[model samples]
Target: MHRHFQGLALLAVAAALAILAPVFCAERPAAAGAAPSPDSQSAAPVVIQVDAAHPTGPYSPAWNYFGADEPNYVYSKNGEKLLRELAALSPAPVHVRLHNLLTTGDGAASLKWGSTNAYREDADGNPVYDWTITDRIFDAMLDAGVQPLVEVGFMPEALSTHPEPYRHDFPKGDIFTGWSYPPKDYAKWAALVTAWATHLRDRYGVESLNGWLWEVWNEPDINYWHGTPEEYDRLYDVTAQAIRSVLPNALIGGPDSTGPGTGRAAEFLEQFLEHCLRGKNSATGGTGAPLNFISFHPKGSPTEVDGHVRMGIQRQLAAMDRGMKIVASFPEYKHTPIILGESDPEGCGACSVATNPSDVYRNGPLYGVSVAEAEARTYELARKNGVVLKGSVTWALEFEDQPYFAGFRDLATNGVDKPVLNVFRMLGMLTGEWLPTTSSGGLPLDDILNSGVTRAPDVNAIATRSEHEVDVFVWNYHDDDVQVPPANVHLNVDGLRQGRVRVEQFRMDSDHSNSYRAWLDMGSPAAPTPEQQAQLERAGKLETLGTPQNLKIAGGRLPLTFDLPRQGVELVRISWR
Candidate 1:
């Protein structure tokens, strides 16, 4: 049956090629003084070098690289398939953080506890916490070999400071409301977290729970939290203390505010840290607050340029660098591990408008390119700043159950893996060792620095080494959508004698391993039938470029030249004989 499917798929691809042949054949006049195309004769292979020392550090192996935080929406039937597909891509334990888990009430006091809400109340009107929904979601994650980043968030319904307008309705036509608000009762909020932590300890065991990082609310500096900076500081102090009270060794940290270096995020983090180090806890009156780590959110802007989506990779990195510097400046927080809890290209997760919408980029090669470039840059920023940057979670995963293709900003669409997820799969297969490499005939970093083209032609590449394997990830992307001129990529690999090496490559682009375009080909998820569903499944499959085989190395370097499409990413893994 699988063979039959493969044959049919091949035929389909052949037909597609035939249809696209004309598009590929058509060409405009070459530029003035441009070299003519080579005749049917032999052409020299472009030599690129890969070095062993000047490499970017291994990708964050322990962080939530391909994780999302949409529990309420993902648990539904439609969202489930998308989540499962994302899990299957790199089933190696991932972290899926649940955002807005609490915040059950309509106002600050009316905690309408239910299955959707993480907390519940008894028949007697007393808050009777229920872990049914939380358990189900976590179970699904665990079953998929994914761990929960375990974001302890929004105040429970019974505890929110203002419950009258409890769960805010999804904003109309791309506008979101109700996510930003302060909890009605800080004590109640703290108690709920304590109870939730205690329950997890009882159920998942203290040691098991200890492995997870407990982050507080998301973007407390923005509309996500309505409380004042001082109020949030007090809230963090109480919440941290409560979690510690339940499980003293549990990893607890946050102020998870907006961009930590600028605006409200920086102020919130500074104030929060200062209070944790010095302010007396309103609940316990203790001088030393429970702050296991420091965290903040950094997001990029979404813009539609030249009919394509471009992510602000540099802006986010700049924010991250600034945030790290700010944290490092504090004497008390100098040693704290920093986590960019909700790091991504944009802030609004639920909006999916096609033209310049928050989620538009998720549907194309732009997402894959953005993620690969951002990850590489994040590592670079960390190295230059000399900070222990821990996890940089991609703020999206899969919406459990939504319309087949409602265009949500998630890693998967209707149970099909998007191109972005393929990037994570490539990252996952990488070994955790840094190698050295250089690029020639490419834009110099200084030129890029001065040009302020942070998003375009941002040639960020990284190589990881194991005793026997070398993995190289290269991405060509720019922030603003623009045509990137092809440049010779010269990669030099050193420190090894000529030996047999095998290369396995994976690529994510408009025509490869992209579920969004596939869905569109199947008439979009909005109008899906069983046949379309099957096709969507097939589309989600990550495509391999070539079979692994031995290559005779002339020198220590392997050289090749290929045209990289705009917003394209390539992962090459080489192993020696």
Candidate 2:
């Protein structure tokens, strides 16, 4: 439960690092808040090619997973608007994970906490389960074309074994308070779960609710859970058994531990898996519990280094690597879908830049760039470890009525989408079969995962070719917060019909699709007028770099060119006839 100590840095040193070619030649600083370019340029650029004809793997949509700490916020004005935006981003249903669904409260939400008032008791202390608030939360998701990852957690006041201090007040800086305690009665806890599952099935229909994911709790390997390991194990067993009693086809899995790269947390996950596979069920007296999937939390540790915020992408990747390795060790779960319960740039999405300078990245384009890198690496990791990655939840969403650019790790501020959200929109545009891609300027996956883009910056791209179109996403990412020169990329298309091609480019940069920069440019107005708000909303959307163009390729091979600024992402789509 300790949060102070830094995890052990596990880097893959044996992986080779490829020196990317300086294709764009000139080292010019990137415009729109990107890194400043070098003084001059060099030659002998590496030529990265995309072979669209050869398919590699399935283009699983991992970008659709999003979440937040406050479950009640899903029904808020901004929360509803943001959910619609997320829903429109992808064709698939957006899966959102939230905490404090069953905690006792008046349906209030805040940074690092939330409550639904799903359980309570009378003066005589009779069990009372209320699904009113919980139903509204799920209703909002379903109405917005989204579904809940369905995190059932945080012991309610009436059910908590240690209910002396039930409610956690984060405004008063109370964390992991009495709500983190275990339940007083196991049968009652299981009954609560059964009622929850039955209510969901009856309300949403069994077929619809069956597709939803149910996780036991938040990060139990950390301070979020106060119970002993065995106690938590028994809790999980009862929770699972109870949920299944109502909806037998329900998909559920958990133990959502902290970063597995951390020594103690890694050991905790291993032991938990061993408990599920080998250890006997504390409640049912069986060999194991029903584990349909596996889940864990991994967070990046960003800090101000050398007067700049350098993101710990390596730390997050190491945790994923270790987590997959641990799961792979168990032959039973090797094929289980692994869900990254919560993935983000750092911990405490509510912590503001006023409190921590390192979080300043949230209000800018770096957040978007980091997301692009994270998406590519996650798929790469799953392939390397031979695992099925069902989803990876981005645990920060909108904080309603928050000041503009407050520096909270959210996709939007006060209803205006951030640059990072645009990245997800770009990812949503890419679907269908996966095309093999190579980038001369892109760093090796191992290098980016282990050391980040600190060495020379990674100008990378991934291509997806569908039946009639090819989409290539490119980015210029660097760990350090400094803005560097934009890298001009020359994308070579290897296999395409020699005919008319229509190309479009969507970009996320300081000036193009970033509302934060627009807000700053407007003198950081605390209260923007109607016109200004309209302008900000427009800027927050996915913007195109230039007018759409048509190309006539003589042969089946074509060459495309574009400039990607540091901490910027560009999606180039080409449709051919």
Error of 1 at 300 (Å): 1.2
- TM for every model, in the order presented, reads 0.82, 0.92
Model 2 TM-score (2 dp): 0.92
* Per-residue lDDT of candidate 1, residues 1-577 (tens digit): 0000010111232322221110000011212243223220113212345666344455445334444444655555655665565565453556666665664532121111112366656777466777776776666665555567766666665555555555443432211234445666566677788888887788778767766778767666766667787777777777777888988887888877777646656877778878888887777877857787787776665544444444555566667877887787887676788887777777655554432232444666776777776666666566666677777877776554355544455676666667777887777766656765544322333333233243224444667787777777766666654444433344455655587788777777777887777776654547578887778767766777767767777756676555455577777777775
Alpha-carbon local distance difference test for all models: 0.60, 0.78
lDDT of predicted model 2: 0.78
Among the numbered candidates, top TM-score falls to 2
Angstrom error of the Cα, residue 398, model 2: value is: 0.8
Error of 2 at 83 (Å): 0.6
